[model samples]
Target: MNSNYHISSFCKIKNNEVSLNGSVIYNNENNNFSAFIKAAYKSLETNYAKFFKMDALSKLAFLAADVLLKNEHLNPEEENNIAIVFSNKASSIDTDRKHQQSIQNKEDYYPSPAVFVYTLPNICIGEISIKYKLFSENSFFIFDAFNAQHLLDNTNSLLSTDKTKKVLCGWVELDGDDYEAFLYLVTNKGSIIHNKQNIVKLYNT
Candidate 1:
């Protein structure tokens, strides 16, 4: 059993609040999702130019992953040792709605290539990978709900096979104005045990 793996850090973003390892790092109750997320981005002090162009789902995922990896020092030799495993219930429906609206009216149909690009949820993974230079195996699963067992299974398989040294796995769901992001980094050293039960409990917390 790959029971030695642990959760080094976790991040939760919901209700216009962002918390890292159980402590609130950013929160804004007065603004909507767009303004709130942008505020959070500014708080991180990251200057990724492309961030502004990403759809809401990508922006949310990017911000959540950024909170975890911001302070991480990547070794050139081990830069490819990190993997990302993310799941979401909505599955890019937020962006799909935008793309659908752009062409739904036949009389004035105008499909946008920019909006079409983000119709798939996995693009957020690409955004994170590009920013952090993580080239390990990455996957995005869509389930009716958050499936921690599946995440555990895949993460354990990757680690046990020595495919990567760490796994960034979590549930990032966004449906219109309702959204939640729970991301955690799993590695050999941490304060929390990496298991199905603990994964579920941490997500709830």
Candidate 2:
């Protein structure tokens, strides 16, 4: 049993507020998602230019993952075993809406391949894997609501298998200007237990 799994760090970003490990890092009354994400990226001092082309949902996931990995010592061997497990209610619907609008009119029909690529929610996982050099197992799930049980079960299952040493799991939901992300890194080291109840408390708290 992977009973030793623990949550080392957590990051929650949404409602114009960003928190790391239960402490608020950035907060504002601003309601703009893209602008705030851009600000967060700049604040992290990351030089990834591809961030500018990502859709809003991917941007949110990318920033949240970046915040979790910031200034942390990552073992090169362990990096490949770091898996991602993400969930959302919208599941790329925000970008789907934009992609639909791109061809709504024949007079101005111009669908973008760049924008089209983000229609699948799992693409963000790929983006994160590429950015952080993670090549381990990963999956993205979409549910009607936040299901901490499913997330925890799958996370533990991955860890139980010897294929992965750590799992980054959470909800990264978005629609228009409304968005929320609560991401946590679970491993064998940390005080917090990686259970369903704890995940719910961390997300709601």
Best by TM-score: 1
Model 2: per-residue Cα lDDT over 113-199, one tens digit each: 888899999998988888778988999999999999998999899888877988889999999999999999999989898887788
lDDT of each: 0.90, 0.86
Model 1 residue 114 distance off true place after TM-score fit, in angstroms: 0.6
The per-residue C-alpha lDDT of model 2 at residue 154 equals: 90
State the lDDT at 78 in candidate 1.
Answer: 49
Residue clash pairs of candidate 2: none
In candidate 1, how many Å is residue 99 off? 0.2
Candidate 2 has an lDDT of 0.86
